[model samples]
Target: MTSRDAKTYEEAVEIVLRTLVKAERIKPTQYARRLVMKEMNPSREARSVSAGLLYSVLQKRGLLDEVIEDVLEITDDVTELDTWVRNAARIAVNEVVFEDGDPDEVADVLHGLVRRLANPGAAAIVKAFTLDLKDYEPPEPEDELDRLKWEYYHPRWLIERWMEMFGDPDEVVALLEANNRRPPLTIRVNTLKVDPEELAERLQRKYRVTVEPGRFLDEILKIPEGLPIGEMPEWEEGLFVIQDEAAALASAVLNPKPGEVVVDLCAAPGGKTTHMAQLMGGEGKIVAIDVDEVRMERLREIAERMGVLDCIETHLMDGREAPEKLGREFADAVLVDPPCSADGTIPKNPERRWRITPDELERLPKFQYELLKAGAEMVKPGGRLLYSTCSMFPEEDEEVVRRFLDEHPEFELLEVKVGDQGFDMPEACRLFPHRHETCGFFIALMGRTG
Candidate 1:
């Protein structure tokens, strides 16, 4: 709780900014938001003010770098300082450039932050802290790629990949720009607990929750704005699960029926696993295998909360061994929701871009391939093996599927009925961030021909 006195906005800003650095930057705003809720004086107004500043800086980080170039001092080899200094500077500059505060006061606060957190030299560098707001200007990049790179807030290599995928210059820029927007609040109803329409009515009547039926799936709903879902009584009662429309579609495409044995190979934090259980009307068994025990706990919790605990069993081990452990060709369906570069989720998980390197992206395909192959091995003859990733890359999606198809002659691409509710994708379909207003996702539903 905040002290009896309302915390100053500056104090709140510092607390949030510092926590962003402490928690690490992949999802800086989310990390910092949690920290403020837990540690900062519980002042709703103050927290919002701080959080507002924090999110702006994170979302427009590239633009901020371009606009506030004069503020940072870099050597020949390094154009950026370490994370602590850079983060504090970003917070400082965000307040100075964007916030409605006195420039000098903002600079003073920032200088103090740097001096305390970094070193004297760092604070001294920006000590003057004077700005002619009108006179300040962003530097122009020499080439087209350089210009788009900083402007869209994506790395040059990633942008190049998009350019290749999109082909058109304008379309590529539009795609990256769309990723910066806040993602929609899409949720899937736990049909095992309550029908979607019934749940929507209950929510509307009781809490006046604004619930719109999903564009495609009757079991899904779009909640325009929501309080923390976990806090909702209906959520505790397991009425719905918060899932992206694209991810929910993956489970739907798998379409597991009641009494069938299903397997989710990469099932930690199992949104799709529980969704499959719901699709089964809580009658079938699902072997949910994941390497991370801690994450699987959440999966278990979701299953238990959704009243489908009897249908799902979670195992703490490598999913690759499912064929051995679960028996060969034992599953009527297998879902491989492997961890890829996760580039498609940049809108929802903004910090992903900052954390991923070109080298790192190159290494994901082999791991994804292994997971997909494992899912295929466990699929019964004519059973579906649904391979999905929150990644838009060909290497992780199309290329991997192509390679798998070539090696396993018996398994062929299965038409997936997804997109705008119930359209068939000829082979595999991509859910583009810009086109679909969902995370960038690629799903390939392959089947054993027998």
Candidate 2:
């Protein structure tokens, strides 16, 4: 808990290693980044460094273990090392294997740093490992899942499910690697003030930043490393809202018109809700409902921040049960971005893979279908209901749509042109990492016929 400047790369690595160990135990995945952010109090440079190191080490664990084995010469039982020591070895190995650093040089650096930061036994282990650094080779996979395990840096079970869905091994590897890399920061330019092209030009001139106009969402600007958009001049003036390209596409697909009453069933953090308000031209009512009180408050705050206050109304109620509270056929349109496995968002939440299970997958579609049915009932006759999820799994995407359509004969699927996002599936449209540069997602637009 003592604060000291990390003077060497080795000391920095030790700090990251210690933080990673503690994060793994305390928060696991979703909360891990927040924990690291809290502990490191990292400058931007340090954030990039620690994140890059953690991912590289995790991705190339096999090669890392070899480096550790070679360095520590005494291979009695490294598995018995305390979590901190194990993590340090992982960090050292990652540096040697992935960074292409000299194994001997890295070993020496790690040994000295461990001696200072860790106890004598830990220092001895690092010293012994360093002395034998040249005797190891990268481990080879013994099976398909093992091969995928190293290739994707994911668990074998998750890869197995992906293989089943994708049916192509090479494509699965590509998908997994894409998920591991840092996703681009995409923001939707608030067209109410400035067009996307003009915003992009201004950003480049002011911050030495570059933004590319997205294909699907005309307002989406792909910003490459600058000041956080929240602090930018454009943001302060309500000229833009930070949103992902895939998420921006959702509002475009919904295509709400002015004077329409739209309900965002699971709106929270207000990304899609605000976008829906923009689509409605900020003229009509948008009842943004979320079950969590905190998220509902956040939705209201974001709406106020983005200057979409005229149209948005916040409500705290579960979408599945809220139709009874609001009455049936109350809105002209309903946008349901339901909770799912979030498999498509692995690039942003790598720890989600560890948290998911077969049972959860089985149960999620049923929950989603119920929400879709409930949300659909809230749509007036001839109104549109858009169901979406940031999940690529068919059960949560196509199957859910198909079942809802089967049960509710009053609604029919509407063909939506997502502007080169991906192929339109039978009951829905899906975006994949291999095809779309955005997060893997699925959307189905349905119109109430009754």
Candidate 3:
């Protein structure tokens, strides 16, 4: 019954700065929302402005840090500075240099902010930006990979890795350009509750936002200008759930049928699980397994909201334990969507490009291979097994699948056909942001023939 106080840009900065510092441990968007709820419930306009600023700052963080390092004339990395000072300088440079904000205005706001934070060290960086950041230009690298890294605001090692995989500079550049773009807001219509046509018409009429059919499935819809689904009544009514086209296609690739027993590994936040349930007309059993109890709880909540909970059974355990607990050769279809560096999600989670390291990339395929082996164990003879990931890396995709297939000769790769999208590899479907306008995804469908 009380009116919330208005939130300022400085408060937003405080939230974003703290988020950037903690983003390595947690998701930036989720952490920022938590901070927003705990600190201030701003108006829609204020929230939009803060969200835009945060996304811009995080998206170009690499280039912004470079600008800050240039402005400070320091040979060392800017990360060595105080947290408050470092983040403050990043925001200042991002706004004035990258976003083309008025330097005097940015300086005035940040100076007051630094004073409030009571960090004398931060004031120097803010002052430095006010003076030198106006006309600062980053030096172009002579090397091609280095040029792409600086120009696209990506890590150099990642660029090199992509170049090696793609083998063509133009294709790599296209992928990089695609990753840098803002991702579209796509939602899957919950057919259990309402049909896609009805839901699309309702959304277009009620919200007045542009809605179009998605590329992958008939039930999928795309909103060019994204709506705040959480606050929308249609979302609360569970007419739809937010999901990407490529993610939805993974379930279709598996093609779970009604009355079949399906197992979903690592199925937390249950997007594909629920989609499979819908495909089955909510008549099949989906054993959803995940290690994180909290995320499993969320999956249950989403499944319940989407009116597909009756078909989905949630289990809190590691996906690798699924075969031992559930018995081998039981499931009609098994979906193994294990963890990875998630480089494919860079378009939506720009912070991911910086967070992913070579070590993590090197270690993930073993885990993925193990999970795929477990999934194979659960599939009955002549049943289907689908291994999918939102990763563009060949090591995580083809190499893991190759290892699994070589070890388990009973499972044979099948051609993946989803709405006329052809696979270059002929056995697995790969979706790219530049070509398919979706997240970089790999879906390999296989059948057990023992």
> Which candidate comes out best when scored by TM-score?
3
Q: Which stretches of candidate 2 lie over 4 Å from their true place?
A: 1-44, 54-93, 96-139, 226-238, 419-424
Q: Is candidate 1 or candidate 2 better by TM-score?
A: 1
Which tens-of-lDDT digit does each residue in 1-450 have in candidate 2?
123333435445655666666776654342355565655555655555565666566555544554455555536645556666777777766665555667676676677767776777887776565445455455689997987776666777888988887798888888987877766667887776677788889888987866677757678877656344434667777787767777777778888899989999999878899988887778889988888787677678767877897798888888888789888998889999998988777665555655567888888988898888889889999899999998888788888888888889988998766633323365467777667878888888999986
Q: Estimate the overall C-alpha local distance difference test score of candidate 2.
A: 0.74
Candidates ranked by lDDT: 3, 1, 2
Clashing pairs in 1: 2-42, 26-351, 216-421
lDDT of each: 0.74, 0.74, 0.81
Tens digits of per-residue lDDT, candidate 1, 21-49, equal 76664333563566556654545565546
- The TM-score of candidate 2 is 0.79
Best by lDDT: 3
Candidate number that wins on TM-score, 2 or 3: 3
